[model samples]
Target chain A: MTQRLKTPLKEDDISSLKAGDEIILSGIIYGARDAAHKRIIESINSNQKLPFELKGSVIFYVGPSPVPPGRKSGAVGPTTSARMDSLTEPLLKKGLMGIIGKGDRNNHLRKLMQKYKCIYFIAPGGISAFLASKIKDIKEIAYNDLGPEAVFEIEVKDFPLFVAYDIQGNNIFELALRRE
Target chain B: MKIIKITKIKNQIKKLIKTASFNLPEDITDSIRQACSAEKNNTAKKILELILKNSEIAAKKKIPLCQDCGNVYIDIKIGENICIEKFSFLQDMADEAVAEAYKENYLRKSIVSDPLFDRINTKDNTPAYLSIVPADTLDGLEINVFLKGGGSENCSFLYMLTPSDSADAIISKVLDAVRQNVTKSCPPVIIGIGIGATSSKVTELARKAAFRNLKIRNADDKYKILENSILEKINNTGIGPAGLGGMTTALAVNIEYMPCHMATLPVAVSFACHSLRRASSKILLP
Candidate 1:
């Protein structure tokens, strides 16, 4: 069964999620990739003001293609979450509630997720075109110089995701592997 | 010698890129369908269905199969009797084709100018990884383009083993590699294994094996049996579709081998995500 989630994701929303629960997410989420993560961390470290509020926010690790002529997005899909593992803690520390990406994360990051009460969600990888159809709107919010890797405020409707890790440290990857 | 124009070649390349970007090859789709039926876990089965549906939407809507768009790899085979008209180098022609296709098709420009220090998007997705091979038996130029995304490429592995290592060792190593990195690449991947060349060449062989026609098995009976064995073992790992779990952890395992030094064995493994986007075209020489 699937649950519908509206952002900005709250403590209750994330806490209720379990590993392997399918979710259809709507409302606003932030788009950021490797370069954008670095800048966000640098700003936080320097005590500079961020362009968007991190608290109660969900960040998607992506570098979407240019918008097509008649579409809100062009092949927008989640990148591998493991690449963002090192840069995730600062955002979580600031009350970032959720992350959406593909693949597994490290145990260390899973522990950190539990401590911070953040949920790690996995979107289907390589299904970019289908994912893009769920995107309702997108606007660049910061670091425009990063091109495709820039930060954007994106609105999604019925974005499909599966919870890979929950606050209790339950992991969908391990459960799936041991299912048989 | 017959003369072929660079302009003609570039246009052919652009067509190949467009086709590959929008279409998921039939072999991959068929295998995924087979996996879906064979899947015992509900999560795995659902993921496979979604993959099939996504491909349908991509083709109908003219959307790129993946956002990565990927760094283009083109293997050009030129026949011995052909001469190019005003050709500087193959790379330049291929790059022009890539730039034009990516822009015209709305494919992402994912290439960076440099590897380390000055990481910057090239914007045009130029400088394709081109390998030009002389085709003595061919009557025309054949180009095969493969779009490989970053996630799967990151899972590629290389290992050096003593010559005495048994096939069991190879099997275990492959299982270990997949166990560690399978989910990272996207599950139900096509794995290419190269066992025998020197370190550098082995990976290339693995890449070629990975991207080679999925319908064709290795020519040697020995390697073919080995391929089937590895495939069974991998599926038995129960990593399943999308690593959420099931019986179809990998769609295929292809192994290419060459004779190497007696004292050392070099092995490489390369992966292609389920997308497995590729297209081929031939240029006629007049």
Candidate 2:
């Protein structure tokens, strides 16, 4: 059975999530990929305030297709998360609670996720249209110059993902490897 | 000798790009369906099923298969007897076709004007990498267009093996590359293994091999056997669909080889996710 969780993902919510658990994530989330992450980290290094708050919130690593005539998002799907690994540390340090993307994470970063009581979720890569259908709305929150890589506030309903890393640093990747 | 109008080439390219962006080629779709049935893990099976459904929706609704839509890569082979009429620059025409098609199809503009210094969206994906191959034959143009997503392309690798390296060393290297990077790209991946060439040519061969149709086998029987073996070993890694764990880590392994110097045995590996998008067509010159 899958777990249905909403936004404002608190510490308890993240702690309760186990690696390999399927989840239906709803409510507000922020979407940013490599370019936006770089800019955000630059801003952070400059000691400027972040555009979006991280506390109890979710970050989706995605660069969606252009919004078609009547759609909230176009073919939105997870990107390979490891690309943002270097920039991700600062964000996690600032109370970023959850991340939704695809593929594996570095071991050191998983430890940082645990230190911050955050979780990493994996959405199946390449099924963008199906994933897009679950999103209800999208608003560009920052870095509009980056276009698709810009930070956007997306409201989703029943967005499906797998909890690949939880607060305890139990990684589904390692578990899967061990099973093999 | 015959000629084809520039506008005809432009329109043909535009239509081909639109088709490739939204649809998986028939061979890849069929392969995915077969993988779904063969997948024992329930999660991986579901992921495979979703992939099939996504392709159907992408085609019917006219939405892109993936947001990345990728860098448009075109390979054109023009017969010497065939001439391009009205305009002569194939590269410019390829860019024009790409710009129009991306705008019309709602495909994401993934290209940056500059790789660094000042990164700006080109707005329309322009400047596709077009390689025009020369041939002396009938008056026809053969074009193959590909849309490879960024995630998988970033994981591609090239290695130059020493002359004395044994087959076991080559096998171990292939396996290591798969284990280290397979999860980074979306899987049941289609892997292209290019062997027996200098450094530069082997990478291109690998990129070409990865997108080659699953139904097409390496002509050499030995390479065909090696391809099957590599596929089996990759699946054994159990990276599964999207690396969640299962038996379908790679749907197929395509190999292409070239004759190279005795001292250099370069190998290149490129991966394409399940959204293997490619389209090909022939245009008869006027």
Candidate 3:
């Protein structure tokens, strides 16, 4: 069943989600990747204000292709989530409620999600053309030097995603592993 | 000896790059169709359907098949009787094509100028990685172009086995790797298993095999059988399309082997995700 949800979700909203539930997300979100993650961590360590507020925010790990003329974005698919695992818990602790990417993260990431009342969503990889149309508005937020890796504030409508990790630590990927 | 113009080759490169991004080869599309029909898992079937739809949209609009257009690799096979004219250095011409295509085609520029530090975007996707080979008794130049994303490249592995190891042992290692790391790359993968060579060359062969058309299998009958076996085992793991769980974790397995020393057996596994982007062209001369 396809469930529709608004972004900048609160704890209760994320807690209601369960692994394997499909969703269509609407509202504003942030797009970021490797370089942006590192910069965020550095900002936190140096005791500087984050460029964007993390509370009630969803971080999408995507370094989208350059937006072609007449289109909102180029192929904007999810990157591998595991690559950002090491730098993720801090964001979750800072009230980051959701993450959207592909692939399985580690037990530690699962535990963090459980502790923080967060959810991990898996956007299908390599389906950018369909997903790109969902973006209604966009602006470069930070790390312009990083180009595609730079952060972008984006508003989306009916963006397709599936719940991979839920608040209670259940992971859809782990469930897939067990159905032997 | 016959002559071919460098400008002609550059023009072909531009077309190859655009075609590789816009239109996935028919064999890969057919393989996806076969997997979708064979998949019993509902989630995997849906994922495969979405992938097919994405490709259809990309073809109609001339958009890139994936956002991560990936690093460009050019494999050139030149004939002994072919005389190249116009450009002094072929790599420069190929790089020019890459730059031009990425800009004009609206493809992503994903190349980093440096590896460890100072990770700057190259702006245009220049300095295409090249692999050149010389051919005998051929009359034209052939070029194979492919795009590889970091997600799939991260799952690639290389192993140096002792001479005494059996085929089953190698297969076991590959299965173990797939079970652990296949999700990182998009699933319904085409695995490239290269056996017998130095560490680097073995990996190279694996990459080459991964980019080859799904219609082509290993020439040797023994390797072909092993390829089938590996494909079956990987599918049984239940990774499925997009790793959502199903009977189609891997669509195909291609094994490439070479003659190596008696003391060592090197094996490399390079798998292509569902969007295995590649194209080829030939420059004929008179």
Candidate 4:
């Protein structure tokens, strides 16, 4: 059965999730791609304030196109999550609750998710137009110089996603591939 | 013969760019619809539905089918006997069209100035990968445009094997590559296999094979048999719609082959996701 999750998801809430579970997310999530993730990690290492708080918040790894007239953002879809695996350790340390992207994560990242009591979600890749309909609002937070790679504060409503990784280090992709 | 100015060519290129970007080809849409109906897994079915719906939304709303609009590739077949005022000016005309298309249609500017460094978005999808081929008959130019996204492009593979390698070996490697690349390249993939050629020719044929209608099979009987067999094996993998584990792993498998060197057998595989964006137009001479 499917479940709905609200953002600022607590550590306990994430712990309850498991691989193969379907989720519909609502509330605030931050958008950060490769460049923005690097910048955020640099801030954390220097003991400085991040552009946005990571605790209990969801981070979506996407670089959206420019918004047309009278639109929130253009086709915003999940990029390859594996690319962000290197910066995941520090972000989990800062209490990141969940992540939304496509594709499989490395074993180390899965272990980190379990260790930190977080969950990983997979939004359908290449369905940007449908995904865009779920986004209610968007505001740029930092890295404006990076164009689409800039970090943005996004508010979504009933945004459909699937649980790929849970607190127990279970991976849906691994399970599915193994069954084949 | 009518003299078509460079500006007219520029406009034609611009319109082709927008048309290919905003619209998913009819054959691909039909394939996705059929896959959605046949898909057993509820999750995979749902993902396919979303993809189909997304394409419709993108078309009606005049937005890109995907954010990474991809590099523009133009294939032009020019007739030898056609008289043109300025034959060499076509490349400049196409580049201008790319610049205008990106600015006017709000398409993403994905091209970079250099490959090694200065990895910057040109802010205009300019410097199109244009190829001009001569045709036997005297006629107007025919253009085929393709917008290839980065994700699927990254999954392309080429293998060089000894002539002694059996057909089974080729099938095994291709299947292995697909299994390894499930979600990364997106599922319900259209696979193109180019066999029996040099390394570069194999790669080129692999890409060219993808542009063929998915419903069509290879002309050669042996290759057709191989294509069908491989298609069956791929679907049985159950990678599903978006690798969530389902019945349909691929939409179609197209194979193109050519003569090869005596000692070597080269094979290239190119994959395209559900949103195969390609269009062709023909201009006939009077």
Q: After superposition, how far is residue B278 of candidate 4 from its true place, in Å?
A: 1.0
Question: How do the residues B219-238 of candidate 2 rate in per-residue lDDT, one tens digit apiece?
Answer: 88988888998899889888
If ranked by lDDT, best first, what sequence of candidates would result?
1, 2, 3, 4
**lDDT of candidate 1 at residue B239, scale 0 to 100:** 85
Q: Compared with the true structure, what per-residue lDDT tens digits does model 3 show for residues B1-286?
A: 7888888888888899999898878998898888888777888888888888888989998778888898899988898788778647788999999999999999888888998899899889888998879987556999889999889999899899999999988999999989888888888788898899888899999998888778988787888899989999998888787677899888899888889988999999997888888989887664
lDDT of every model, 2 decimals? 0.89, 0.87, 0.86, 0.83
Expressed as tens digits, the lDDT of each residue in A48-159 for candidate 4 is 9899989999999887766788987677788778888898999999999889988887788888888988788998777887788888998888978767778989999999
Query: Interface RMSDs of all predictions?
Result: 1.0, 1.0, 1.2, 1.6
Please tell me which model should have the higher DockQ, number 2 or number 3. Answer: 2
Would you list the clashing residue pairs of candidate 1?
none
Q: Chain A TM-scores, one per candidate?
A: 0.98, 0.95, 0.95, 0.96
Model 4, which residues run further than 4 Å from truth? A177-180, B1-3, B83-85
lDDT string for model 4 (B1-286, tens) is: 5465667667777788888877888888898898889877777888888888999998998777887777788888777566556868888778888888878887767665676665566667778988888887746877888888777887799999899998899899889998887577777888889898899989888888877788788988999998989888998987877778887778888999999999999999998877777878876765
Between candidates 3 and 4, name the one with more favorable DockQ: 3
Could you tell which candidate, 1 or 2, scores higher by DockQ? 2
lDDT of candidate 3 at residue B148, scale 0 to 100: 92
- Please give the distance, in angstroms, between residue A90's alpha carbon in candidate 1 and its true position after superposition: 0.9
For candidate 4, give the DockQ: 0.61
Writing each residue's lDDT as its tens digit, candidate 1 over A1-180 gives: 589999998788877788999999999999998989999999999999987899999999888888889888888888888998899999989999999998888888999999999999999888888998899998888998777888989999999999999899999999886678
